[model samples]
Target: MEQPLPKSWSIHTRPEVIAKYEILERVGSGAYSDVYRARRLSDNLIVALKEVHDYQSAFREIEALQMLHNCPNIVVLHEYFWREDEDAVLVLEFLRTDLAAVIRDAKKKEGGIRVGEIKRWMLQILCGVDACHRNMIVHRDLKPGNLLVSDDGVLKLADFGQARILMEPGFDGDDDNHQLPVEQNTGYQENVTPPLDVVADAHSLPDQGFNKQVVEDTNREEYLRQLVELKAKRHAVDETDKETNINDGYSSCLATGTISDIDDDPLKSSYSYDAEEGGDGRNGALTSCVGTRWFRAPELLYGSTDYGLEVDLWSLGCIFSELLTLEPLFPGISDIDQLGRIINVLGNLTEEVWPSCCKLPDYKTISFAKIENPTGLEACLPNKSADEISIVKRLVCYNPASRATTMELLNDKYFDEEPLPLPVTELHVPLTKNNHDEDSPGGWHDYDDMGSDSDFGDFGHFKVENTGSGFSMQFS
Candidate 1:
């Protein structure tokens, strides 16, 4: 018999150890780990370093990450080693922000991730995924978050070596108990399941059920959260029992069919989603995140056990749908209702297609409504062109086999009709002409020649060149 490896393999040194790079502020974090900003002592330039307790989660994949450092689309790995002095550290390219940061900032304006923007994002992701696939790597947790951008406006695929970090269970929320094997949550969200005591403790607290209104049960966070937030603030409690008794004035008046106590709390209570309600909200199993839940594939919603890359495709489709129309394609409170949203729009799965699916772990319990007459493309995206509508339909199709591959989607007619160009390269310019002005750090050929001020939502320099035929980029 072989001796098993330890869980805490090796980690980066703490309190600013100067090996090759000087440690800086943290940029990203995992359930049990943290990533930081570090500067090269030699040049005083910044770079990102991922420090973990060990490499036990990666097994042999560490070699894979080290081998593919040549790929530009990937976050280049600088160096890796166990600080015999402390833990292990992974030095990498320091990107400015992830897609989440970019999208949140961009959404404030009308022009969110546009069709061209979506293409550019998807195209860059395809390049990354294809490269990973070529190397036989599967980024099981690929979301908008994993796609990152640097201050230089370059998009890079992060977490190629993420499997180690993704070793914990996430998506299949119900099955995982407090005590599960390290292998159980592999490929799922990291450390999603709270310890048994935590989950039990949360539910044990009297759930106030639903509010008096019809929307109470229909809207989970909107109603009770409203009351919970209001009650948490303003209405202070003198006694502990009063604080526990949630049937305070908010519900008291709501039940009387009177609009008196429905005083919307101006002091909005922010629900800490990361709060797990365990002993201290930490060390507890989590249900789902608002962001990752958006891209959950239909099979997972329907309770399918064995799934694969198609899950990522489903999320990609959903994200694309949201980007296309600026609305969530399948927004449901519960898994059953989520399936209904999917069925209503994309049509239910035919038995011939999802034949073996009924045998999944959650299948016996979930009885989804089979919508024979689902809505069509016109109904789904009212103003979208035939080509754009068709693309979304294919992407969100229920049959996993029938789902479009990333490559197939990259060549979609929609992107073709509204062609998106890659980041422009000055490779064609002469060596003399290629010289950028020293005044600008990016070495701009002519910074003053750039376009006028942009509208909030429009990021792409979308201007139709007035050639013989018009070339407008805006969607009607």
Candidate 2:
């Protein structure tokens, strides 16, 4: 029998990383990556090293973060390492805690979170999301856990494993004329060259700046060899080990690597909607199987493949609701239960509400009895003022078109009212807790045992009965 590789041989323990940074402790873990708190040996700067096992996710995250490097609300990528045949490692700014921890800490306090503090956090989240949306990127997974807070109370969007670029940066005019080929398996185009401006904007740590040489002479030689090979082929797409299906029980919220192999030549991918076919286009379809069950948008729950930035808006509403109430607004046990919960509150999704409702893949397959007098947002947020309720209402609605954009929400009058959003310096920053605590850095606790998949076993026989006030599921 072959001997198992030692823990020291792990990707995070690569010689290039171990030589330059002192590994402090493992901070977080997930399906595709492991995060560690490390200290740079040269300048003694603390940073998080993310070792990503999945190639495609690493590629997506690296490209997204690089594009949004100048955005204040998005997490900064200090640098990254991606040697051939090795896992990509990202060096990210060290954020002590996340929004989930802040929410958890608020729940323990007497009056819950302060109105001003809530506003500040919400503003930061909106800013980050707005930056992504404006850049034509959609962060498919936008839960509180992915919102990291620095020691100075600055909240930045962190995880981008499920993020997708809607279109090439400058080619936004006509979708019909410029239809880019997309990989059916990965939902991204293969071997597409990145724009010149994007290549020029790629940020990397300066060489020969800090203490001793960051890369040893021997390591530099190896790096140069890899760089030459990468340039020679123009970073050819590696289709091996690609995630073929989005619904393969892999969590989209998993942590991804810091650097990407295809960093220099970012993949150009886009989603196309065919009006005649209802949703999916001939070019390609964006996966609806993204995001956590609770925070997933209604269109995604109903299996709408042709989605856009609006999905993140729905998640933003869910996160804001949790911030206000310290409880998840919709904590459904399964995808079916999730949809049912939405119906129980928002009433049946109809053509009157969303003209494209019938286009959803599962709209006919999974039918629910009409909900009469559905519970309103006011009921869910009884203590919240009308203005607060209105904010949530704009986001959680069935009509994706009606959902408020990040820029619109940022300029809302809610922020102009008394008890205004606290300044970044004055905001209360929560203490970083161990993984065992409920408020782990990246919402680690929330990822465990998120119900079973048995509920989706027989979708053909799926039936949802309206139980007067709520919904109950039955199958035959």
Q: How would you encode candidate 1's per-residue C-alpha lDDT over 1-476 as one tens digit per residue?
A: 99754434323424333556677665544432356777888888787766544333222224435444555566665655443333456566776555544454444457655555555555556656544543434454455455666554455666543321111222111111232233212122232331111001111112232112212343433433433442333122211222221211111001111111211111101111111211232222221211233455765544332334455567677666665665557654333445556667766555565654543333443343466777855686777767767767776776665666654554455544534433312001121212223464421122111111112123222233343443322211
Per-residue CA lDDT of model 2 for 1-476, tens digit only, reads 99865544275458777888899877666556677778999999998888776666667787788778767778877777776666778788888777877877776679988887787788778878877876678887888767888788877888786677765311111133322222211212233333211111101212111111323556445544543443233212111121321222222222211222111111111111111211233333455656666788987777665566778889999999999998888886566677777888898889888766775655665667778889978888978988899999999998776788765675578877867776677767777633235344423354433322335543335556665546544433
Give candidate 2's whole-model lDDT: 0.63
Query: What's each prediction's TM-score?
Result: 0.55, 0.71
Q: Which one wins on TM-score? A: 2
Model 1: worst 10 consecutive residues (lDDT sum): 251-260
| Candidate 1 Cα misplacement greater than 4 A, ranges | 1-17, 54-64, 83-87, 161-291, 302-305, 331-337, 376-380, 422-476
lDDT for residue 404 in candidate 1, whole number 0-100: 67
Backbone Cα, N, C clashes tallied per candidate: 14, 1
> What TM-score does candidate 2 get on C-alpha atoms?
0.71
User: Which model scores highest in lDDT?
Assistant: 2
